[model samples]
Target: MNKHDFKMGFILLLTLCIMPARAADINAGKSKAAVCAGCHGSAGVSNNPMWPTLAGQSSAYLEKQLKNFKAGLRENSTMSAIAKDLSDADMQNLAAYFASLPGKSAGGDAAFAAKGKEKAAMCMGCHGQELKGNGQFPKLAGQHPDYLAKQLHDFKSGERKSGQMNAISKTLSDDDIKALAEYLGAL
Candidate 1:
């Protein structure tokens, strides 16, 4: 899109920010989330450090991302394939299932956590307490290590280009991003 279209798109999308915390359907979500379990983990917590932990994430963010994946705006072969088959209700169900679960730490990996703490201080401005996130910011605490690292890289390199995230990530070093991702996943 051109600059004008980009601006209009962002404004329209932002205006439609759907953080319906109350609109989630946990029962339906449980069923839809089963499919998500393959990548996001059984309880929205992925064991794979490369995948992001989805537990405790904002339903709005999850829903939006699923939409983006399906629309091919956010390019990911795995997520796109998964999202392509989902309906709006299915997205809501999956979002509810993941959001309802309690977030778990990466567990038993403390050495890197300290470094992660320092890096995360910058992140807290948007991600909120415990990285549960607020508004448009996504939950980062207990997120997948690999997902976080990839996103950070994406933000810095312009593959991902949200105004705030891109700005925040630009200030980080590669090591800083790695440390933060590791720490956030363990939360």
Candidate 2:
């Protein structure tokens, strides 16, 4: 290559190497997230029953889901529409913005938490005190109660396949799922 071309290529490589891997403008995400506010919440958490609370979800995981929605790998009408128009940079920025936000608990009902706490004791070893799941285990704290319940049911019925959760969930009854979902929402 010519000297000028070589120098330009080197500069481009250097810029790509030095740029922050997760640098995304939250402001841009805010604008892009407007439609998402209906389900994911203006802040990324959701009050919607079927929709999952995206707050505190792993950025990598959220990015994957967003792409999944767009690709039709995940089935959600609203979410798929939202994802369809997103560019890679838009998805990245959205992930960064949501990941950077603080996670909020919906504040569990005292009665449900009291009952769920008992159930939570059984879960604490892996799920932690606040039910905020660690690596690979999705955070249960403040997750949508309906979504959690559906997952539990899916696990029980083999609708959802997870070698990890399938075994653990086989033991959970419908009642257990209800209690756990209630408790998790409170956290």
Candidate 3:
């Protein structure tokens, strides 16, 4: 290459190296999240337990779910429509925005927590020992109890289909599900 071309190439490479692989613009995300405020609240914490609080969730996990909803891998009628038009960058930005917000905490039953601890052992393999997930696995700690119960129900009923989750959840009773939710939500 010519000297000028070599210089430009080196500069480009240096710039790329310094840039994050999925650089999200938080300002842009705030603007893009306007529509989400209805269900997810202005700060990404949904008042309705059924809707789930996205605040303080791992960015990678949030991004993956958005993509999955768009792709129809995870079927949610409302989420699918909302996510349909989101670009990869938009999803990344939204994820980052939500992840930047604060999370919530819930109360737990001591009796249920004891029972749920045994059940939660299975989740540790993927969700980490503390239930603070990494990458694609969601952080279950401090989530909504009703949301967790509904998700377990959905997994069991095939409304939300995951081969592993379906298999694991199908065996759980209503009490087990409730206990698990109570335990995890309290953390």
Candidate 4:
């Protein structure tokens, strides 16, 4: 082989060797997700308004959030502790399992949802037209209204930092946040 060909082949082999070999295992994820059932249901849904449902959320988004919590980029009393012990593979598996489940809606007030829809136009760019989410944006549709509102409040207060969300949340009034949450949750 030519010198250049040999060099290229070595680089490719090294790159492949450095990459992870295992794909995410949904069954393993389900087993690991047992601890989460208390708050995020066994099926990745949630009964309490205080907790956000994990079902049907983007796997990328779920993985990113778990990493964030582990790295201290995101702060939550419960999640931080839970994420601390998780390995990268564990996070990936959990994200995959949750994303595989179907999402449920908790219908909202028509008047509030109507008002919120208009305000949510700005969110469509990243969150998608149906608010189903794209890549790392997260599925806002069908989330608990209270959970959504709390996240918005945190973003506004700078407790949870996101360049776009922090700026957009700052522009929202209390009523606007409520309406937006109600609207998104109903979907």
Candidate with best TM-score? 4
lDDT head-to-head 1 vs 4, winner: 4
Shift of residue 186 alpha carbon in model 1, Å: 3.1
Model 3 is weakest, by summed lDDT over 10 consecutive residues, at 105-114
lDDT of 4 by residue, 28-104 (tens): 89999999999999898999999989999999999999999999999997999999999999999999999999999
Model 1: residues >4 Å from true position, as ranges?
Answer: 1-22
Could you give candidate 2's per-residue lDDT for residues 38-124 as a string of tens digits? Answer: 877888888777777777866666777788889987666777888898998899778767776778776555665667667777666
lDDT of each prediction vs. the true structure?
0.82, 0.76, 0.89, 0.94
Clash pairs, candidate 4, are none
TM-score versus the correct structure, for each prediction: 0.79, 0.74, 0.85, 0.91
Candidate of highest lDDT: 4
Could you tell me the TM-score of candidate 3? 0.85
Check candidate 2 and list the clashing pairs: 108-186
Q: What lDDT score is found at residue 107 in candidate 4? A: 71
- Check candidate 3 and list the clashing pairs: none
User: Distance (Å) between predicted and true CA of 5, model 1?
Assistant: 36
Model 4 C-alpha RMSD to native = 2.8
Cα lDDT tens digits, model 1, 46-117, are 878778888888888888999999999898899999999999988887887777888877742467777888
